[model samples]
Target: MRAHKITFAALAVIAGLSLTACQNDDDAAAKTDPSPVTTASPSSGDSGSDGSDPASPEASSGGKDTSAGTGSDKPGQAAKCRTDGLKITAIDNFIDGDPDGTVAVEMKNTSGRDCVIAGFAGVDLKTNAGTLSAERKGEPGDPYVLKSGKSIAFSVTYPLNETGGSGVRITGLVVTPPNETKSVTLPWPGKPSLPVTDGSGDPVRVGPIGSAGQGG
Candidate 1:
């Protein structure tokens, strides 16, 4: 009877040990593989307060689409329009003649719109001493139409002798478009001066005169 009681107790201990081992294996498996769960609640207002739809692609990307034109689609902006459509390119040459010297003014139309040059174009010669003398060339007539990307050349003959200088001094050259009082200055290679036969019978090199002045 004593031996049988001992065997019964051993069997009970083995059963308990087996049950505990199975429970431990289940707990480890659950920890290793976790499943994702979805909730009904929305994340934020941008996600849609009513929860009907997702945010637009732009909104989701965090900004508005700017590929399309938004503001200021005019050909030339207001500020650009204020200035004449013409831009001075190169002052080709200055020729010494009866007057001080004639300056060749070259210009380019840089604006998007076509430039119509109809009225008077003026070029001012300034001595190193800051004395300003202006020469007017071309009167109002048929507009000198310059399409976009086109160039035009005009001459402004000034009395270089009047300036009383061996070298022609050109402080500034400006062109005034029709109906517009403002003038745009033509860019020159260097300080305005050209050598040539002085107006006097005696040949005096007036310096480098503009090619336009020489009728080039």
Candidate 2:
């Protein structure tokens, strides 16, 4: 009977030890294996809500500002038109060869006093390609002396070899009275003139009678 009691106590002690060891093991596992902490990802749309990135071009480039500098793409950026007292009264297109044509530019001294045009009046023909055909000197007359409010006319012609469109530019009227230079640019019909050079290092050739002067 005593031996049986001793065996029963020993089994009870062993069972208690096993329960305590299991409880200790459970506590150790709870401390070592904690719940994982979550992290944000770029694809998860988590950056916008936070104040990290301001989400602007300036912010992306280290807060450096970007703007159009001087002479930017804006209206009214072109140079304004400049005009002097000299005036061009008329530019007449006269007959040349058969079906082709020519142009004669008539300039008038519109100023009240007599103006001395020291240099030769020049005519530049601009082509469709924006290329200048040649510069011709106008038929220079005697030093034009005009009475106040009176006018005198000077003419220059450009000849066309073939039928098409060409642009005409008239310049080089150096008015000595006001000491100013004036020019006029217009589009007219004509073919390119034959290129030539002159003694003054300017081009000079007899074009269709009207298109005469220093060639470009």
Candidate 3:
């Protein structure tokens, strides 16, 4: 009976040791396992590693601004009109090409873009003797915004030569547009010779630049 009790006690101790070893192995496995990882997402205003922000002024401008300033696509900001971009012509409005007539000079904008013109046009009659400059005779008013394919005009008025007296023989005309230094030459539309001195003995007169198809 005593021998049987000793064997049972020894078996109980061996079972306890086996259970302890199992618990120690479970603890070691828990310590060696790795944890779960986490990552964050970028927000709307957040800048990435390159230090760029979507809401910033520099970013919104796309590194270059092309919508403002001169030469841009903005309206009414065109450059001034130049003589090289203009087409000038003249029409004599006298009955039977006689004196006491008016010469209507028209300037058309041939440039592909918009431009501006203002004030009086410089006028000089090309004659055999010399170039006779016509005197400016009215207010210039306001600056005119001449769009592409548009026109403006000025006029020259002279007295009638009823006596048939000796006068200047006009061959051509030298025209200068408003606010421009360059000039253009055009032929006189009608009778070349007109009395230099009027019935009252006065020189010819010129007018300011105005709308086309109108007097001066």
Candidate 4:
């Protein structure tokens, strides 16, 4: 019976040791192979309130736009007008009820294609003594588009020599279009108009080119 008791105690100790070894193995496994951690990824194709996409190709590059044309590739704009194919005329007494002495010069664009004209026409008064270039007056406005067969004109205004003052008598005029080197000559249209002085303050001045009717 004693031997039987001893054998039962030995069996219980062996079972307890087996249970301890199993618990140790489970702890080691938990330390070596842990649970995977979950993280959030950044959102794609997210366009902000400013209508720009942060992840787009344009944003990645630097937001430079090259879709529009450059240099001579301007769209919808005509070339500058040239004096070669133009027909020019000068008329005296073009405008009635004028206090200042005025001469109107008109230009017709005979060029087959459309072109543009801006600023003032170059005007020089021809006198018995010498030629005097008229000064440009007023700020230049936007360019005026002169379609084929269309016309534009400008005026030369000066204080009339009403008092028979000793002034230069203008006999003719030499006119050049803006941005053009060539010029045209026209005889001054009326009885010679005289200027008090062609000097700085009282100089003859040319107006900006505009509709043909304005010149008259």
Candidate 5:
């Protein structure tokens, strides 16, 4: 009976060891191969914002939308308006706010290529003895793109008694465009429309150069 009891205890110990080993095997398998997780993929056709490719007009040209008609010329590529390409002409006009004797002027772009003009045109009322400088008037505004055959306007205003009591007559005016060194002579009206300067060093009151046919 003692030998049988010892054999039964040994059998019980062996069965417990086998059961523990099976549990450890299962834990190891669970760690090595886990259940796969599902994830959504991105759309293969999506390029970027605005639903357009990288080579689109707004993207390729450095963020410029060419369809909006901004301009073809790039910044710093084209030169300023040249004296040779400009044709200055004089027109008589009387504006309420301006002085009594106002001479309207036009700067036509005769150049074959597009150019830029802005601010005021330097004016020197040409006299027989010497040239009298014109006092610039008005605030400087944005530059205008003067394309081929397009033009802009500016004016030179004079005092009511332009003769300065000397009865002097102005033959014409020597106009130098903004950023230009050379000056062009624009013939005055048949009579003395521009007043003779009193050597006050005050400008002849030149206006800003804006769109063509529009008095500036």
Candidate 6:
């Protein structure tokens, strides 16, 4: 009976050790294995690896900004009218084989790009006796953007002949562009006779430059 008790006690101790081993195994598995996670955490303010918030101006602009750069794809503002790109033509004849004293002035854009043109074109009718500056008439309208191969027409008004009066001789002429300091020189229109001014004030009258089909 004592031997049976000893055997039973030994069996009980063995069972206890097996249960402890099972408990230790379960704890190790829980510590090593990963828990179930369904989704990733949401990003905060689109921060970069350098911890910079994307919304900040420094982060958005970076070290070199390209918003105002010329190479950017964004559209830029229109450029102002320039004189060197203009081609001035003196129109003395309304049609072939006919001549008039109104001296029509026309300009063509040769800059190969779009440019703004406004106000009156400067006209200096040079003569041997005296030089006449154009007296501008009326206010300027909205600016006209002229592309390549486009043209605008204007006029300088003066009498062609005086009828028994000593007429002024036409020599060379000077043309000035609007809002520009440079001037273009053109030859005389075949020595046409112009009305002589009394030296009172500016003689030649200039019409405000307008688009095609628009009269001044």
State the lDDT of candidate 5 residue by residue for 114-173, as single tens digits: 565556788877766666687777686555556567667777776655444654557788
lDDT for each residue of candidate 4 in 17-125, tens digit (9 for 90 to 100): 7767856766777677676777999767532322221222221122211221111113444556788867899887445666667777888878886565667889998
**lDDT pick, better of 1 and 3:** 3
Better of 1 and 5 by lDDT: 5
Q: Which ten residues in a row have the lowest lDDT in candidate 5?
A: 58-67
By lDDT, the better pick of 1 and 2 is: 1
lDDT per residue, candidate 2, 1-216, as tens digits?
111122566657667577678567667776776667779775653332211222223211122111211111134221111125345433344454534333443333444433233224444544333334334344423222222233333334333333233323323222111123455655443333422323333332212211222111
The candidate, 2 or 3, that scores higher on lDDT is 3
What residue runs in model 4 are displaced by over 4 Å at the alpha carbon?
1-77, 94-97, 165-167, 196-201, 211-216
- C-alpha positional error of residue 103 in candidate 3 after TM-score superposition, expressed in Å: 0.6
Tens-digit lDDT string for candidate 6 (1-216):
111123666667667567678567667776666466679898655222221111222211112111211111123433445778878877563343344346666677777765555678788878768777768866765455454566776767655554566578778778887877898888756337665656652356777766222221
Best by TM-score: 4
lDDT tens digits by residue: candidate 1, 43-134? 55432222112112221112222221111224431111223565655453554334434445555557865433333444444445453434
lDDT for every model? 0.41, 0.34, 0.62, 0.64, 0.60, 0.57
By TM-score rank, best first, the candidates go 4, 3, 5, 6, 1, 2
Clashing pairs in 5: 134-203, 134-204, 135-203, 135-204
Clashes of each: 18, 5, 0, 0, 4, 0
In angstroms, give how far residue 211 of model 2 lies from its true place: 10
Any runs in candidate 1 off by more than 4 Å, and if so which? 1-84, 94-100, 131-139, 160-169, 174-178, 185-216
> Which of the two, 3 or 4, has more TM-score?
4
The collision pairs in model 3 are none
Q: TM-score of the candidate numbered 4?
A: 0.59
By lDDT: ranked, best first: 4, 3, 5, 6, 1, 2
Candidate 1 vs candidate 4: which has greater TM-score?
4
Residue 38 alpha-carbon offset, candidate 2, angstroms: 99
TM-score of 3: 0.58
User: Which candidate model has the greater TM-score, 3 or 5?
Assistant: 3
- Candidate no. 2 TM-score: 0.35
As a TM-score, model 5 comes out at 0.56
